[model samples]
Target: MSDSQHHNEEEQAKIRTSRALAALTIAANAQISVEDACASVVDESGDEGLDAIGITLARGEIYVVQAKASSGSPSPTEVLKFNQGIRYLLDWDWDSLGGKTQKRRGEIEAASEDDVKVIAIFSHFGAQKTDEAATKLSDKLLSEVNSSGNILDFQYQGLRENHDNRNIASGLGLPDYDLVFERWITMNDYRSEIMGVVTGDQLARMVDSFNERLFDKNIRAVLKATDTNKILDATLERSPQDFWYYNNGITIVSNSISCARTSPRTADETFKLQGLSVVNGAQTCGALGRALRENAPLEDVRVTVRVMSKEGHSEDFTKKVTRYTNTQNQVTNREFVSLDPYQQELSESLLSEQIQYSFRTGQTLDYDEHAFAFDLEEATRALACLTGVDNATRAKREIGRMWSDITANPYRELFPRNLHPATMYNAVQFRRVFDERYMASSRWMDTRSGGIIKNSTYMACALFMQKARNEKLDFSDIDLDVESWVSSKGADIYGLAAIVVELHENENPGGFPMSFFKNRQKIEEFARKVRTRFQETGS
Candidate 1:
């Protein structure tokens, strides 16, 4: 072959590799394999304008991908091409399509009529333009499809700098395990499902073994260390038998499920599950894990399990089951937390001081009570700061993860049983005060300059608590004179905010302001500065 032909082939190979790598990154998110994706050389050869088009064998969902390796920003034409390809799939114009796409036409056509999830992927090596003309076209396509009563997500993987395809399946999947699902009762009313009980011991062991992956199919991420999760732990510890009746059991969606032959009536059914996901009861699962960590007794604990066998064919059906089971009259974690006596006690304590603490999800504060009303999250914020700089950083990071460990290190440190409600009230009032005075005084907080100072609020509250401790403030006494405390600590707060903001903006900080807040060393350094300032000013 001529040198020109050889060079042309090499260039073509580069383009193919680049596009395939980009496509695979997005395909990975759909749990689609590289073998499953369009890694073929002539992916863009089709007049259909898509680089890749195929359905996931596991989910029966379509993936229409458009990829390009660019030195600069990806052109608007790429999005238009992607749009053309999606429209082709919608219409199934087989006669004009390429050989590879045509081969998959039967699968595409089968899924076209159904309300399937079409992951419209646009993978590129160039920088993304969220509001560019191309982006507008992409958004238009997604909006058009989503509005048409289908779940269409445009997965954009803009691989600007890195070209590494090695991390494609870095997150492969949850393990397939065989668990004994107790006394399975086949549900005749619902198609392809079985109801059974899962012991807390077995569930806890699964959580310990699998961790977060066990809840991968769940609509919600593993909500660890929430009040609801803590409540579950408490239930298991207190009355494990009552848990089955009190708790709404978990729902599972399995890739494949096969029961052992002829188990006796009382015998636990041994089901071999190839792949599975807990579609509901993420809180229960997470709490079970926490319970195991705390060594909470799970002796008599049993949770009901309803498994919807996906079997690949029923992917659409399983999707609907995951949706309705999770959304239909769902008892929110907030509701479960509200049942905890600590919440009611805290509510009553705060109410006595003319502050309404809304703990439940649907519970609303009166318009008149807006000044004094705060929700569970707000209280967490205040308590987080009051716990001092270390726990404050954890709260800044993820307070939800800290709030549930009431029996242990983090939250137990904050809300010790003997810890006065007065202390909590004071901290909350101080939070409101700081928020009202220094934090919300200006409109520029959304700006770059203000964003720096905006992140200093938590630190400010923490510094105030530290000062209160140094001064030996009355914790047991319910003092309604929050304004007095605020008046005393106002200077310290302003000083801390100014100092922290200056340190962040002027000094070469590690990361973003929010990230800097989450950093322990950074938080400690800033706290030290604030403490030094407090000493100098003699507050």
Candidate 2:
């Protein structure tokens, strides 16, 4: 054969192998079909940086994938190019990517910006180098960002040719099983109406069969070595009997549910269930699986289960049940408010304006979930500032009080159902400027004036709003970037600083400003003094 012909053939083979490896790697990581993964791959000529990318539906995180079909792992240059590609995407430099990738701008933008993953995968030939390469990449990325908790990280994988992707091809394999529930009670049309206890042995059997796919569709459901899982591991290892009370149990949504027809089925001892998928309690299952793998003895451990059959329910309603039921126990109060219709509506409205509204504690971002975005925590602080001086003080001193009982007074009054979305946008924009300009940059000095302004941030914002409205400053706009109406009000926008400094000095002489800001009586006096200044400045 001619040398040119041999070289061309070799080049073609390399391209084919690389594309094949890309499909397999994405399928393995995302648990999607190889067909879908192949379709998402960027095969354009100039696209040397990224090979393929996808978003995880469960966590709403964007995962960028790079595949190397050569021996002994992808070279350092390939890794650097992959990192550069991700940086380009994050910076929104769409023109630098291929045409197909640029067309996906909207979908890419919609995914979680605050949390992204870049997976670097190699051919099975590189299996021996995978672990060491993965560790070095992780360490290098952390060092580059100077943050262990950064929004981006590297994950390395070696795709074995012998392994079957069939199970995972079906997407997070919770294979059709006759789910057995003990002492079950009937609740609706699909059968045993939805309450039961699942035995530990049953979970053991399922874990043995399903592996990591057991927790698909769960909220924020990536099972790692989290502190929550650590507690679960300890409990399962040492105290199996008390597991039921400590664990929040699992909530399942079945494609269909059934039971034996022997007598009235409501009081049955157990029954058959097909297509059972857990929407919550992934941590419990993971911990139990870990314990069993280590040969830890388990006794009298049963998980309380609630099943929401998808027979007649709307898609949105079923999703709501899943999101609400899946929250970590400590954040349940804040997370539960996500079920409120108003919060969802407001969230939708804010999206067009580029502001990410986070009503749920575990909510994935809509626009930008990072610090610059208008988030729920800052929104609450802004609302408290506008609500009254007392609320402002409480908001700074103890913000958790607002979210402690979402259905009750302080939370309800601050985020009433009647509250309009525009008002929230305006308030958030107003307070966000203060936080970013002063608090975030540590622009405040240890001097008394700096201390006063920094400590009384929320209260000062509240008073600023009052004075601005009297001066007729507009507050109805909601454009996040191109138009932050509140922040653009010129030098006079910070006219409240002089008033705040004077108020703090006059009301709490010789006292620490932090203590003064948190004190209700002192804040009330400060607000009164600011109002008096606003009125008397007519001179």
Candidate 3:
């Protein structure tokens, strides 16, 4: 060994150290571990393949982030690689057959079923252009999640010029993360829509029940915008036997808008006409008092004085006066709380002017869609009359939730056995489908129907489908492998089942000889037994 040679080797080592340091610096800046970031690799062997590195642990259903590192910018490409590696690590089953890979996290090897999850952390990997690979992996994920007809979603910041991955996910019916976020916003909107239909305790109980039923289920059950309208509607309709799973962990009810309004009026008031001031007489010279145009009918008009007579007392007054009435008096008949000649006439003129404008526009009630929107409108009007909190968004949301719950979620836990098994299944399916769809779809309010209801539209659609399937009952040419045909045919099956059950129930409501919906007790027992059976079967 020559000294010169030793110096050359030292120089090479310094370069390697600098490159590694740069990688770490980049990862930190990107807010990802070096393991999550990927440095391009020139070769599979030696340090050329080195990039980021980290370790991870699985917890229940979500992946627990642990020691991880990224080696470059957190670009979309980097995200793809990181996610791919994570998926690979999660799916790996070491005990199955092949020898364990070097990246295997030892702790997971002995974990039981409950402890396992499709989650992982990474330490190191390199960027490799594999559009084909990315496409295949994303497709598989979408298929797996959507096959069961569950809502799927994803979220990311901003927009992209080209997002093949997102497009593919959408085409396969998997919602991007953004969809979930949007649904959450929509859920808030829906809460506002239904908060006016029920009482406070009832709403609270509904939420409590929903949360309780979902507590034992996975977090996946907590999708946004759950259509509590069905349950709420059922309650409102006075159908007592249709409440579904009680403990879903989410808020079940909200305060009604009407319940939240504040009334603050002592009684009716009257105002006598007051002489008009001539402060701006020059401005109105041409039309001192030309025939006044009457817009609104003289009714329930209010007048108020802000100033005080050396004392702090409000000078507000009301009047009921007619406009352009042709009568024997040749004078307009008016009623007022008090006639302080100075205040009464002026107030009446002003009131008349405002009413004229109101009448021209034909201003009336603003229509809403809830079954009981009138009640809320009445409340709003009453509250407005009192004068305090005028517009209450929270109150409305609370009220809407309450009303929706009462209308939906029937309490028929023990459906009579006279109802056929298929009918029972359809009912169960409707509840499930309604819940799932309601959770996913935007709130559909029908003011004409009453007030703002939740997605009873979905249930209505379900019913329609149920009927359609029964009518178009033909599955002789079905081929399960052909995706399009399979889906098309499945719709028919689901619909037919619903209709049959409905007909059976209608035909024999008085203790029909059916196994599933025979009577309250039998149906209840069957539900318990069936649920237990499903659990045993690992469904």
Candidate 4:
């Protein structure tokens, strides 16, 4: 092939890879399926700086992605391209663009700018360059977006970024072998806990080696530098000697830990940990690594490290430890589920009944290990359905709102005191069936009108399932009936959903009404009217 052809092929490959990665990230972060994520992505190939475009359904946020598959950092030209794309998006410029770009632009224009959260993601497969030109370009773009009064968030991910990290069979660039410690001190009875001091150089090496794997179990994503991080950086710069006392230390989890102590009585020892990972203190560790890369003076800096073996610990227990250690920092309420004894018991009960249950979001349970597992968001929606919440399905997509309700409501009342494992399983299964049925109409549902109508459809389906199973139906019976009903009347049900969507839109033209999904009486009355209409049609 000619050189031009080769370059084109390379760019095409990057586009394909970046789109796939962006879809996966959306699915994992949004707790949706890979297929759903792909469906949301709009193709705008010739739209200059835009590569992959997706809108997060739950949060009503738009994600504009620019992906570079190169091993080197994105160039100044790439940054300018991204800047131009954002300008077009914000300025509502479409006449200068191609048909596909204009079409996508129209869809975005339908939503009010205030309601939309625009996230610009620049992804590459190597470390991002922070040289003068690149940095200046980035600052200019960021400043323009900031001054535009738009809710725009910029995220840059490189090969070392956690967006690419996952615990898969193929091992997505995670390091192999154990991280060794030259001198350590045991802190527990079973030799599972060890505490020691690590030099700044050693800390940087570990971060470079493990990268995103260090935060495998963390509930939150790796955040940008905040005011807290600034303080830590200043401390590291000025008082390297006081670093150990100022910092809370790092916590790590591993499959096993082996120690070869240099002395019998002294605290000095050499420790080697296998399958090691930092479950907590990701920000602190990340900051230290960045500082070291910038050539910070830290030869004498000694940061405390705690390593715990997961040999005797259940996954649930390990997660709890991570949750507790991270409490000093800002985290989502969902992260605190590990501290709930009822959640732990619920997980255990489900396991005993041969069902896999994960209380945390973004966790993948192998089907071979268990019969069924529900994502936390899915389970939350089911609970909402079972309890007669009007827009219960909406809770599945709204993490902050869901967290608020979860913390405010009594656990016994929100989740029944004597909840049966089978019932919980059935609720999740019912929601899954409903989702599958609705998604089958994706050809229409992927359109703007269809997308607006989708959430109401989900709520309606959940209500339908609840009403069907009201008479103490068995799990198998409920599943069969739901499947049959969906197969026969799915289209009519979706039509009803579209009607509900119209009603809401007409009532509140600015956005979806807050009362639309919250009022139990209103929702049930709408459902009754839909049922009456279905009966009258008698198809």
Candidate 5:
């Protein structure tokens, strides 16, 4: 044969070999549904039933397998049609195993190596249809297969080929048994199962369970589209040493316009420019203060920072500024060194410094869940202990408190002075914000209703802010007006309101409208009421 002809034949042979190997690999090792023709056994009670094995992923993918023996089974063409239906109903993805896309077939290649994730799959089922009607019904299931990347359907099919003769085609396997199973799983749905497989809460914490790889893809895509590198460097950083962190200090500053200032400044004015800086600075300091709080014992809390520069002038300048995270006061006195003296000559244009602050405990970022938990622990603990608590009730109460807290001040620690007004946060402002859900609880609801409750205390604070603004009023009468306004909203909104009102009212008898305070007791009580009422009652 000519070389070209021989090469062409070899290519075709490779293709056939590849296909055959794939088919055999799947048939031998893959979990499959087997059908046996003999009647299934019945219990002494004389009930008619067929038992089969199946596999499932959490709301994700499902594979059902059944085996049957038929001496005169339908043709392979007929079986292929039936297999299509099973793939559709169960929503299984076909295996391409790293191949180029097939436009006509509408097949998608696997995403990236890191991107594909295994969903929790239960097992494979095998069973024989109970009757001839059932057998024909299986034939009707052939219409559902598709090649869309977005949908999961059809993995592989297997039939018993070598076992018997006169069985015609003898055995048939369709992409993992279709048979109209119930549900498909999403990324979030398989979280628990993923947790089981990956074996680390820390890993799960860093990466989104199912969508982690997807998220990383999106982040890169966004950075690329925005040309964000030119705008700001280092999108992800494990430490302050990242290039973005040390950009010519000029580039590191936020580019947005600062707010305007007025005398006897309001938050609107203070949060604009100078006030925001002060607020952030103070918040950073506050994080340090909370870490030092007496109740929470912390160890290995250390802070060391220094700036190195090529020029002596830069060395002097570095000393003028304060450096610290929210650690202890003892950290303030750490040596602010000019490491340049210890090193060889430095250039005036270049500078570097290591500022290390470590807190073995009590280092809480303003929005960190730990910080929030610390603030809410007192109340949550007590409430959770109640005897009659239920799941729905617990969900509602906890959801309400969580939303209330998060929405009330997402950036509070970061920008305390210019805290975004609650009303301005359309995402979290509605009464329904409190009705949000955690990962698991959402499945229980048919409609998934009613989680957040803006108790009277919140209403009081909101109402106080609203009325004072509307009436061209001063906060001088905050206690009286807040109480009255909260009372008007309803007893429930007012219930927690009264407690805070009385507490604050006593702290400042002369009437102080201190906007921020940690009322842990109240926050937990609210969380408990929500957890008990919603979770226990399944409301």
Candidate 6:
């Protein structure tokens, strides 16, 4: 091969690697799967100035990347090309772009114009401090994009070395802070905590450098600007100097924290914190970064961060701290479950029994090892049924409200101190069976019929399980017979449920109220009638 051809191939390989790294960074930052990130990428060939595109479904935002793997700063022309690419994306000028870009446009066209658009420029060579012309070009492009009445943001990330990419790939890794100033201080009744303060610029750099991985351990979901966030933004805007006084410091929990104080003369210290994650004040941190990016007077802002060492601390203890620190907002039952010691014990027990149990929301369960794992939310719903909560079947439809109910009253009784993990496990398995059998039946096609059938079937399954437990029968031993019974009697059961639904609808012609189902007495009466009919048919 010619020398020039070999060099071109080498450059292409580098570009491919950089693009893949960029994709991983996007996935890590967005908290999405790599496959999803890859799906959003626009082909490099005939690519209209954009290297890749990533869409965050949860945040309703799109990220367009322009990555350069060169050993030096990206040229002014390269910056201009990046700018032009964003323009094309914003203007929806698909005709001027390649098919892949056009396809991406179509994928995101359903998103509202108000959705956020972030243009990220990634470079192996540092884009900070050097490349003044490139910075100017970026500013010009951002101004143009912002003037178009779109919620747009521009971020320049310079990964100075290959190790930088590796750091980003690890979801919990910290960005390269400008100056790590660490100090040891003892709190009352606790081991000394490592306190560090970073300037607003450094915080902004960290936010721009990494993804949501920083706040991965936080209990609360990513919040949009709330009253609290607004207050934080205002404080940063008006009195950035008093930021430390005005704001409660951020709390971070990590497995280990290390610091090297090189010189007594210099206050700067090099700190390496491993398995680090922000447990509290995620919104505050996010707002600070936003304020700095939006030209808030944050250059002098010094934010204090409290780092608690996770050494000698149990995972449950760390989770408890995380849960307590986030009590300013209404903590969900699922969040509570995640911190409950009993829940952790149950999860471990289930794991030992070859059954997966996820006490945390959004935790992935390996279905191959275990038939299924119940997330706290799903487990709560099943518990609601087992405890005889009115309209327990409605938990499937209104999961959020059901959680609130589960945390209170008759529903909460289901999670008594001495409650066995087997009861909860069996309830989940029964619900899964009901769901599978009901959905598979031909009766599921009709919307009205399907709704009634679902509620009745759940009631039937719950009653059967309760009866089995009362009689001290092996629940799994009767699984085959139960499945057969449900399969055969599904139509008859639905027919009875349909009659009940029709009666309720006729009684209140002004649309059937959900209160009708909330009547436990009425549902029990229907369930008894269905059971009697099934018994007569069997005899």
Which candidate number maximizes lDDT?
A: 1
How do the residues 1-539 of candidate 4 rate in per-residue lDDT, one tens digit apiece?
12224457767675566667656544443333345556545445456676656553224366776666667777888888887776566545565444455766655665422245678877677665544686587676666454424356777777766344333312433233343454566755425787777776677677655444445545334423333454567778888888888777788877777645543333434466777667776767766776776788777777788888888777776778877876664544566666666777778877876778888755787689886777566676776666554546335334334544344553344465567666677777777777676655545542433444554555666655655565455543323354555456576656555565555545433233322443355556655665565445542
Q: Can you write out model 1's per-residue Cα lDDT over 1-539, one digit (the tens) per residue?
A: 12224457778676656566545654465444344444432264554566766453223256666666664555677677767766555545465567767776665655543324677766666665543787788777766544424456676666632344346345446557676866777755223577888788888887666543456444542353344565676788888789999888888887877755654244476776667777888878866766787688886888988877775465486667767776766553435456557778888877877878887887887759544777877777888888888877777765655655445667667767776777777778777877776675334333443555666677777887777777777645675576677776656666656666666654432223444555677678767876786677666
TM-score of each: 0.50, 0.47, 0.18, 0.40, 0.20, 0.38
lDDT of 2 by residue, 52-156 (tens): 775553332455767676666656666667666765665455767877688888866545322233344333346555555545654575444322123555666
List per-candidate RMSD values in Å. Answer: 14.7, 14.0, 28.9, 14.9, 26.9, 16.2
Model 1 RMSD to the real structure?
14.7
lDDT values, one for every candidate:
0.64, 0.62, 0.25, 0.59, 0.23, 0.59
C-alpha lDDT of residue 83 in model 4 = 70
The TM-score of candidate 6 is 0.38
What C-alpha lDDT does candidate 1 achieve relative to the native structure? Answer: 0.64
Model 6 regions more than 4 Å off? 1-61, 65-115, 120-184, 188-192, 195-205, 217-220, 261-272, 294-304, 316-318, 330-539
- Badly placed stretches (over 4 Å) of model 3 are 1-61, 64-76, 84-414, 417-465, 468-539
Of 1 and 5, the candidate ranking higher by TM-score: 1
User: Ten consecutive residues with minimal summed lDDT in candidate 4?
Assistant: 166-175
lDDT, candidate 5, at 144: 20
The list of candidate 2 runs beyond 4 A from truth reads 1-13, 59-62, 90-93, 113-124, 127-138, 146-153, 159-174, 177-180, 185-195, 199-539
Ranking by TM-score: 1, 2, 4, 6, 5, 3
Candidate 1 stretches with Cα past 4 Å from truth are 1-20, 29-192, 195-249, 254-278, 282-305, 310-320, 327-354, 359-362, 369-371, 394-426, 436-456, 468-494, 502-508, 512-526, 537-539
Per-residue lDDT tens digits for candidate 3, residues 222-272, read 121122322332332342222222211122111111111143112221111
Candidate 4 structure, TM-score to reference: 0.40
